[model samples]
Target: MFLIFDNFIFDLDGTIINSSKEVFQCFAMAFESVNYDIDKTRLNPDIIGPPLKEIIKLIAPELNDENKINLICQNFRQIYDNDENDCSELYDGILEFLKKLKKHNKKVFMATFKPMIPTIRLVNKFKLNDLFDDIYGIDKFGKHITKEEMIEDIISKYNLNREKTVMIGDAPTDVIAAKNTGIFGIGTLWGYGSDKTELKKNSNLCINNIKELDSNCEFERILK
Candidate 1:
């Protein structure tokens, strides 16, 4: 399966690391500091994939102004930065899969809506720098950036072959981004995307588990 693609771009939060617990805590603490009330139960599963600032705005709209939103986001960053390693864990087989990709001479990269500071921090913390060729994340100020834009940046910068490059993620946006850019998208069931139906509908291939990356049937579908 990995042999077919010369280059791979991945999403950070759900696709690469299961950081939902830490993310939820960051949101909860920041929301509390801003005096905005939110339920912990409402945080997880739905709120994992989107940009932190955007999620903060949606869940606690009362933090209406940019100033207030920025304040909460800042606090969230502090909390997350304090104990990122303890909070998140890489999914099983991820390290081995990445090593395999490198061994196969495939170029790997990351494109996530997460802010750049923590994104780089996490990558460095996990010692994943050698495995990935490049990593892209939103600006520090939390400016608006789309998935398509991120993919395009990677495409323009590296001159990647769209035909041989694929965007793999846990969300439908991933598929839409790749489809818009005339490439392939592979959706994963292990991520935070609640609507698996939509992901399958938009993606070139939707795999139920990480091990399926090694499945002959799944890879054959991509070739077809």
Candidate 2:
């Protein structure tokens, strides 16, 4: 049987919900609002998993004005945070897997770099608010915290056992965070970060399907 963990920390963007397209659209809208010409082709899909500040810095390095960056970021959040669900969709089997975790008495939490307001909105919109024990988003004061910091904080706040905790995410940053925070990391291939070599090198386990979270495959097991 797969090793069952007591606490599971999940990443929001590519892991739990497919919000990359919406993210890109928001960026586009933000540029339009400021009459800044944005070359849509320059926006990479891999940019979705990182913090919004990082994304802005990467995509618009020439826009050095902090005020402008904040304005764009705010505009992006405003458009994407609306009640209407645009392109966001839950990955196949995620809802069912979450239900199973809940039934198994697992403590679920979301650790995302997305701002708190929009993150909570999406969680509630997807009707997933009840499943998570706690949610960690970027600070309201615009302080950008790393995934490692967020995971460490969660561990301390919840008094979780490091030996029985796991981080589930789709990016290298997530794996790094789990490793830095002394927890097992499970990388999902179905999401945006499909680099198996990178994931296998960092994560304790890597799963292509949600059901594989409980797989008995010897190769997939994290024996610790």
Candidate 3:
């Protein structure tokens, strides 16, 4: 299964590193600092895949004011970015799997909803720069874009063959992006945002562990 694709695009937060703790903590602090009341239950790990503003809306739907939303986002960034001790850790077997892909000369890239500043910070913190061919976030500039658009940009920029490219992620958005861009999507079960039913329905293949990508592990495939 792994040999079929020459290129792999991965999601960052839920797919590669588990940043749920850091994310939730920073969001909580941000909301408190902004005097916004939120349901703590809405701050679960499932909300980690989308952009900060989207996540804020989901967690605090009552916040309809654009100015307030922007303020909260700014506060969250200040709190999260300045925290030297980010509790994000790579999922088990991820490092080894990435190395295996590199050894096989596969082209690997990252397409994360996280902004470039913190994305680069995490990549550097984890010492993953050498493993990936390139890394991308929601936007390099202030332009608003969808995850599908970001994926499409990566495909076009690299001239990746759709048939030989796969997007591996833990969220339905990731699968949807790959589908929208005409590439294969591999759903990972071990990540924070994984919804078994949603992923099983949308993904070309679903993997339980990162090691499965290197082995002939049995996977659930939904033929579209």
> Candidate 2, residues 1-224: lDDT per residue as tens digits?
55658788999888889887777788888889988887677676666777777788877878888988898888887887774857788988889888867877778999988888888888878899889999999773368788988888889988999988899988888898899989989988877843567777899888878767756322223323
**Pairwise TM-score winner, candidates 1 and 3:** 3
- Pick out the ten consecutive residues of candidate 2 with the lowest summed lDDT: 215-224
Q: Give the winner by lDDT.
A: 3
- The reply for model 3, stretches above 4 Å from the true place, is 1-3, 217-224
- Model 1: pairs clashing at backbone N, Cα or C within 3 Å: none
Cand. 3 Cα-lDDT: 0.84
Off by over 4 Å in 1: 1-3, 61-66, 140-143, 216-224
Top candidate by TM-score: 3
| Per-residue lDDT of model 3, residues 21-113, tens digit only | 889999999999989889999989878787788899889988899998999999999988777899989999899888877877778999888
Report how far off residue 118 is in candidate 2 (Å): 0.8
TM-score (all chains, Cα) for each model: 0.88, 0.88, 0.90
**Global fold similarity of model 1 (TM-score):** 0.88
Q: Rank the candidates by TM-score, best first.
A: 3, 2, 1
